[model samples]
Target: MPWTLPSRPSRRSLLAGAAGVAGAALLTGCSDDRPAGGESGIPLERRMREAAVRDSARLLERYDATAADHPALAARLAPLRAAVAAHSAALALPPAGSRSPSASPTGGTGAAAPSAGGEPVPPKPAEALTALADAERSLSEARTIDLAGAPGELARMLASVAACGAVHAYLLTSTPGATS
Candidate 1:
């Protein structure tokens, strides 16, 4: 008997299989079994959220410092800085028991000003932007790596914020308004 070739997979079947694989991947990433509560009694997810907020605040401070040190770039940097500020606020946690865990971040109207501290801004405008871009890129990579450990809602927010940071890094280096 001759062996026959198998029929091609239907589009719907293919899509369904793909979705299952994607979901499994997400589940696998989220299945990290580290202890739920740490020495401080805060759960891993909460600590992750807090750390994200602090990182955003520091990034915001860096943006502000860069803008102040290089006033000429201020106009170009304002929108990106505002975006960072928004990320910080969105990552802030509401008072304990004040809101549902699945609900979005709340409690703070804005991130408290943070300082990256000590390092002076670069003297040249291009150099300052490069430094800012570097910071954004580094933080974005860290957040991306962190998604594996984050729970559902927090993971989604981290992904969004991380994408934004990457975009900010790109924009700072190649401003659309520039004639180049």
Candidate 2:
């Protein structure tokens, strides 16, 4: 297979993205620019949503391979994956791609292999849930910060994401151990 270069960023696209982010910052005061070591100010809600989507994709890929054993679990997980995909699309985040389990990761000698056909893979789920929770926690902290200082839409959107994250966490934890 031939490697294709990523498309160059267009000036208009760059400006538009910057404008959205800057507007978000100006509205929410969550700008990336801050005094050294200060808060990142990036909205946690958006971050949480993005993270959840990514986690969902990875989990779906794993579930897809093992769905034969747990049809109901796979079915339940399918909607969750769809929800994640929808949320990711709404936020304009990149989608996950399929890759073989044997592919080597850049920094390690041992490749990160998919588990044996029916082996329970707890760590991925655990790590994903933990990250999702952390993102929600961060959003909560951001919400507590004075929104009187920034833009209304940014603050509102951030708060919305916090709520979404909480809901996502509950959904993830409540799912069965062997989903289809």
Candidate 3:
């Protein structure tokens, strides 16, 4: 037979082989044995949950401080404050003993500290209410974003909390007594 050269591999064949190698690497590279929110790493879900919990605690603290500074507004703020407290409690991490290493400390869950020696004079009722409404609006917006990344149960809980915050914002801004 006359001398003949072997045909070279086509571009399509080369690409197919490359793809198969990449797929196999991906399949074997991931390890499911790592603990959830453990030393190896904190999953995205845990990070989002922790952030939500921290934000809820901060909101509760702010409400408490504002109420303390303006005792006259406490009655009007009670419902909103209670709502924030409920959200904080719901999102709070388990106790330190049972929590993972990646979990945030529970210190944020405590009562608001007095400002320095004594409480400063509070802002005007209208200003304070406006500030609270703004904060609630922000929190609600944040929760809405976090909901996208959360697990099914967490997403539902976050949706409920976001709705509560939005309602709280509306009520705070519109209530006749609060604007005074």
Candidate 4:
């Protein structure tokens, strides 16, 4: 006779399903219906903090890649990269998986980007340090306003991350081998 158990799920199946849902939620948090522009009447400061995470992740990749290309800049950049990575982790932002635009010489639009092979592009450096600088400033300015009414620790963390962004901007701007 075949050995048969109850039809109900065993402990493992229930745990597995819960784990799968949790993983999916983690991966898809960006689309959580948080309105953009604070157009939802949400304050701009809240928006700035969220934007900082996304911008930081993208810039971290670009700077890290560009720094990698120039041997001299790489050592100086290690700490900066580590700081960005830490900030990204704190914000629960995804890591930058895309290759640098410099890597392929295919222009700033790397194969990783969705655009087609040929397109006239602006003169912006493939490295995103400049954009990071802008985002940092925006967040810093927003922090002055009475936004994010509660969650003190989170607000403080965002402020600290914004400061890190300022430092990053200074390093990227003044450091040798940083692209225009």
TM-score for all predictions? 0.72, 0.33, 0.62, 0.42
By TM-score, the better pick of 1 and 4 is: 1
Model 3, residue pairs in steric clash: none
RMSD in Å for candidate 2, one decimal? 18.9
Look at candidate 1 and tell me the lDDT of residue 51: 86
Candidate 4 on 114-170: residue-level lDDT in tens?
Answer: 223322222344344454445445544554231233134445566577677676667
Best by TM-score: 1
Q: Model 1, range 1-180, lDDT digits (tens) per residue?
A: 999756998898899998997676467456442446445666666678778888887787888889899888899899999898788777776434546655556334544555636357889999999999999999999998787667766777888999999999999899666785
Higher-lDDT candidate among 2 and 4? 4
At residue 126, what lDDT does model 2 achieve? 48
Instruction: Report the number of the highest-lDDT candidate.
Output: 1
For candidate 1, the lDDT comes to 0.78
Q: Which sequence of candidate numbers ranks them by TM-score, best first?
A: 1, 3, 4, 2
lDDT of 3: 0.70
lDDT pick, better of 1 and 3: 1
TM-score of 2: 0.33
Error of 2 at 86 (Å): 1.5
